[model samples]
Target: MKKSISNSLLLLSGIIILASCHSKKQLVKRQADSSAVRTDNAASAVKNKINAIKSKQVSFTTFSGKAKTKLNVNGNSNDVTMNIRIQKNQKIWVSITAVIGIEVARALITPDSILVINKLQSVYIKKPFSYIYTYASRQVNYKTVESLLVGNAIPELLNENGKLEPSNGNVVIDGQLQDLLYKLIIGPDLKVTSTDLSNQSAGQSLHIDNSAFVQADGRVIPSEIAFSSTVKNKTIQADLKYSKTEFDQPLDFPFSIPSRFSQVN
Candidate 1:
């Protein structure tokens, strides 16, 4: 069970990637009236729309939240509690606990390295950021991970390649970056609602949905978030509901590796 929780927490930090788009057709082009001129680009309004969506991302110096997580990895399902803390663009801390508040695992991630301690097994893993990215997607960076955790749009999608399309009340942007095709949906209030990413040749795809929203720390964010991803036979899905959250609070990141613990590569 500890191993499963370890895998769950480890992948939770790694699974968030900027590769979101449904299909080439959903994102690329849509049917247009014959009399109307078509211009995916070449419109200044397109830039304004993208910028407005970016401006809605949450801004904070420090954040803390406790989430009730339902996690399924490799067909094994588990219910656990997650205590998450983030110091803006600096570091992210996470603690996973089971029933009776028994802490089974803890992890700390930074821009340069990653560290994990499995209390149940007396083992630890320490490696560079590349180690986790190798299993997930290279497109995922520290900033994207931080943004996704708080229901913010991934910065990668707002680049020059982003093509804004005509939509109703919500804002939608889609484009292709290398082999990764991407799309982003922003709610009427300018918060990110859904993100989809796919790579047909690589047989990889991922989706994240923010089903509901609420006021947290004076900012509106997704109260419930769901993630579903598949790569070949491996499947991972998780749903998180924020039970309590705070922002800009004084916090501590306590990490001291015990000598008795063995380090795993």
Candidate 2:
């Protein structure tokens, strides 16, 4: 009788394990369905917002404000503070200062090219703005640059032109923690997922919301930006307040390649 009882116990344990596995599978399926629904909803909302922003007929005059950026690459980190100004024809001026040394760098950008003047080195480099991604060390992405200027992603700015078609890729903003990606294709959607923000000292994740508002000049811009990113195991955060915007000012591109400076390809 005792031997029979032991065998029965083993059989019951096997059944329990099978039941647990099946339950886990069901949970995973439910989670995936929820995620899919969330993505669809976010995509739809972004489309509506884009349409509304473009429907307005006013041209913005000028926009200016302060911005801060922090980057972490393979454990090394740096912080930068910048003053940004933009004009209506997509002319942009950005003055960046390093946080540790206060080393100032200036960049002037037009629709065609970008000119970067390094005050610390007293040198200037001219290239296509898109090329900066390939050359700069510990450089931020173009999307970050757009965010710094207008609290919007680069693709959103392009969407305003009605000629620039969105791409079919997603960017991992603030690194892998938040799992948020902006889908430029399909419908230019902003999809957000879970991110680690608990350890502020360890660089919290960043979450970008889809809710943007039009400025007084009728240009669509993000009113509130939630910035959370981890850099060098350091928790840094800021609520960037932007105002006093002006758009459509004329900016003469004042960058010339000096023969004296060594050419860097």
The top-ranked prediction according to lDDT is 1
Each candidate's clash count: 7, 9
Candidate 2 lDDT at 229 equals 39
Tens digits of per-residue lDDT for model 1, 168-231: 7555778887778888876666677788887767667788997556666667677778889876
TM-score of each: 0.87, 0.44
Query: lDDT of each model, Cα atoms only?
Result: 0.74, 0.38
Best TM-score among the predictions, by candidate number: 1
Off by over 4 Å in 2: 1-50, 56-59, 100-103, 129-148, 152-220, 223-260
In model 1, state the lDDT of residue 207. Answer: 88
What is candidate 2's lDDT per residue for 117-189, written digit by digit as tens?
A: 6555445666765553232212234433443345334333323222223234321222212322222211222
Q: Give candidate 2's error at residue 125 in angstroms.
A: 2.3
Worst 10 residues of 1 by lDDT: 18-27
Q: Pull out the clashing pairs in model 1.
A: 19-197, 20-182, 20-183, 20-196, 20-197, 21-196, 21-197
